[model samples]
Target chain A: MYKVKVYITLRESVLDPQGAAVQQSLHSLTYNEVSDVRVGKYVELTIKDTDRDLDQLVKEMCEKLLANTVIEAYRYDVEEVITQ
Target chain B: MYKVKVYITLRESVLDPQGAAVQQSLHSLTYNEVSDVRVGKYVELTIKDTDRDLDQLVKEMCEKLLANTVIEAYRYDVEEVITQ
Candidate 1:
């Protein structure tokens, strides 16, 4: 099996209102040292071993379903899992 | 400055309905090799230099605002940023 960890975040040019709200909340809570905040999605997928190229498959999955490529960008790390 | 990357995931014992929905969607999209899926939150914080211990400060922030500790578990990675 393989474990894939994917991170999807807004493009650098995009405005992240959710992040801004979180920063504001932190400020209200007196965490004044925080200068900025960006929020994103983290997904973990467990896939059974397959003959298909893993990296290619992951990229296809991200583009087609995991990420909204218009306003968001995604990256992933894949690792093999050892099962007893 | 310090850049902190935080990942908040549901505790292993908790039911993740959002993750289940995502898995179902992926299956419908024909990614049948995927055996399981888990979704979580990824937050990036840009914090101005502080005299406080960075790790402890981040831990406090996670407990106080970033994560709901009752059902979620969080981990963070911190790196120093150099400004020219």
Candidate 2:
């Protein structure tokens, strides 16, 4: 099986309200050293054995559904899992 | 400044309904090879210069707000951001 880790984040040009809220909360907590914050999504997938190119499949998935390419960007890391 | 990347995932024993839904969608897309899915959160924090221990502060933030430690686990990667 293949273990895929996908990270999705807002485009630099986008504003993230959730991140802003968290930053404000940090400041209130006296974590004044926090300069900025951006929230994102992480997705982990375990795939059964497949003959198709894993990278291509993952990219397709990300572009089609995992991420909204219009405002967000995504990248992935794949690992081989050995299960007995 | 420090760019901290935080990853929060549900505990292995926890049930992830969102992940399951995504997996079902993938299956409907003919990506039937997908075996499992887990959805998580990724947070990016830009921290200002501080003499205090960043690692400790990050841990505190994760435990208090970034994650629900009762059912989720979090890990982080810190990077030094160089600005001229």
Candidate 3:
């Protein structure tokens, strides 16, 4: 089996209103050192072993379902899981 | 400056319906090799240099505002950013 960690974030050119709100809230609560904030999604997937290429499968899933590629970019790390 | 990456995830005991929905969607799209899924939040913060301990400050923010400690757990990584 494999464990996949995927992170999807807004593209550099895109605006992230939610992140701005969080930053403002932090400032209100006196965390003024925070200068910028960006909010994104993190997904963990446990996959059974497969003959198909793992990276290709993950990319396909991210493109087709996990991420809105028009405004978001995604990257993933895959780890092998040892099962007894 | 420092770049802080925070990941907030539901505790293992809590059920994740959103993750289940995504997994179902993936199965419908024929990615049958996936066995489990969990969805979480990723927040990136750009922090100005401060005398306060960086890790403590981040942990405080996560406990006070960034994460719902009742149902979620958060972890962070801080990397120093050099400005030329």
Task: Give the top-scoring candidate (TM-score).
Answer: 3
Provide the TM-score for each candidate, comma-separated.
Answer: 0.98, 0.98, 0.99
Residue A77 displacement in candidate 3 (angstroms): 0.5
Which stretches of model 3 miss by more than 4 angstroms?
none
Candidate 2 off by > 4 Å = none
The numbered model that scores best in lDDT is 3
Per-residue lDDT of candidate 3, residues A1-80 (tens digit): 99999999999899999999999999998999999999999999999999999999999999999999999999999999
Instruction: Put down candidate 1 lDDT per residue, B1-84, tens digits, no spaces.
Output: 999999999999999999898889888988889988999999999999998888888999999999999999999999999999
List A-chain TM-scores for all predictions.
0.98, 0.97, 0.98
Least lDDT summed over 10 consecutive residues: which range in candidate 1 chain B? B22-31
Say which prediction, candidate 2 or candidate 3, comes out ahead on DockQ. Answer: 3
Report, for every candidate in turn, its global Cα lDDT versus the true structure: 0.94, 0.95, 0.97
Model 3 scores a C-alpha lDDT of 0.97
Distance (Å) between predicted and true CA of A7, model 2?
Answer: 0.2
The collision pairs in model 2 are none
First chain of candidate 1, TM-score: 0.98
